[model samples]
Target: DFSEGLARVKVGNKWGFIKEEGGVVIPPQFDEVYDFSEGLAVVKIGNKYRYIDKEGGFVFNIEFEWAQSFSGGQARVKFGDKYFEINKEGKIITQGREDLFPVKIGDKYGYIDISFNIRIEPQFDEACDFREDLAAVKIKDKWGYINKEGEIKIKPRFAGCLSFSEGLAAVSEFDKKWGYINKDGKYEIQPKFDMAMDFSGDRAEVKIGLTRYYINRNGEIIKEIIDIEHEEI
Candidate 1:
């Protein structure tokens, strides 16, 4: 059992969910099952797909040929030759793959919502996928952050920037020194390293001069590496 409080287990030729105590929560009745997300999971019966609640109840009667897990309150579904986006209530929101995909218009990039409505206008020179509810976008040569609603949460200031990870993102400003910034665009670790990587397990690997080391969230050097070569930045 994981965070969803249930784990998939194989029983004979079928699959079911087991609780933390190894008790069956959902009986092995479906041909296939997917992990739960947003309190629902996708289950397959024969060649049809539908969502089921944590209690193993069907969320809606409409079944599709294929489906994807919910993300940002929407899931992609395929019926016949057309693809659609639907909400948790199984209501169709859109008719194509736009919110889950980046759209390119002319020389700019932007994104849409589950309704096929333009959430972000095509104004960025480049854009990256959303991570941790925010996406990194480039305007000319600087990078910034935007919320899912397409609002500029962080202004374009960094010469280079990466997507958010563990509440912080690595950024640089022309000097080739990298640092970590919070969601509010404030520098948690002052830009001083030659290179930096995303924070993992409360620490990040950074390079200064030719030495590499790991720094904690407080920007304290916790460990040092002496064998890593000074790679080109």
Candidate 2:
């Protein structure tokens, strides 16, 4: 797929870049390539990954075992077994910071502290990072919220859910409808929308059928769009 005015194409066993007009910009030479982002792209040569400019020139002096496209002027790279974020100049900017990160053991998921100590035992079918002091966990197929201590604050009942944002989490129940629920598992807004997103500031975007709109924390429609072709919200 095309990104930032260029698309990745494979010729023989080598990957390269082509302009929107179907002309070769960067010749097929790398073993693999990722879409352009922030004016640069990640390309793999042998087992090492490196960033390259649009003109196919190397952007950084260092190479990574694995690298991701740049976003917000930073990209994630893996060295040894640890992942770190690097700036455009290939300088490590950030390392691990979460107090507890999710880890999988066998078929169940649990939480481990930054020191690699098991804080929560593996029991839930799925687990996510803590947000606002709670994390979304799944048992079998139902989703719910749990505290840092692994206590099930909200029983697994939702068909799907997003982590808490501004004290409310978007959850779906019967009929696949989505709504906002408070930390106590009480519905702040009734389930009705076909799709829902996490709240940013005071508003969240939602979709019902072909209609899309923004709703306030009170579940009131602040803005609406009708009969628009379905695309990313």
How does each model score on TM-score?
Answer: 0.54, 0.58
Model 2 over residues 1-233: C-alpha lDDT tens digits?
A: 89999999899999999999889999999999999999999999999898899999998676667899999988887643456677776766625434666767557888866433578998988888898889999999999999999999999998899999999999999566899999889999989899999999999999988789999999999999656588888
Clashing residue pairs, backbone N/CA/C < 3 A, model 2: none
Off by over 4 Å in 1: 1-100, 113-117, 226-233
Kindly provide the TM-score of model 2 when superposed on the true structure, using C-alpha atoms.
0.58
Best by lDDT: 2
Clashes per prediction?
Answer: 0, 0
Candidate 1 TM-score to native: 0.54
Pick the TM-score winner: 2
lDDT by candidate, in order shown: 0.82, 0.86
Lowest-scoring 10 consecutive residues by lDDT in candidate 2?
Answer: 91-100
- Candidate 1 residue lDDT tens string, 108-144: 8887554334567888888886888889899899999
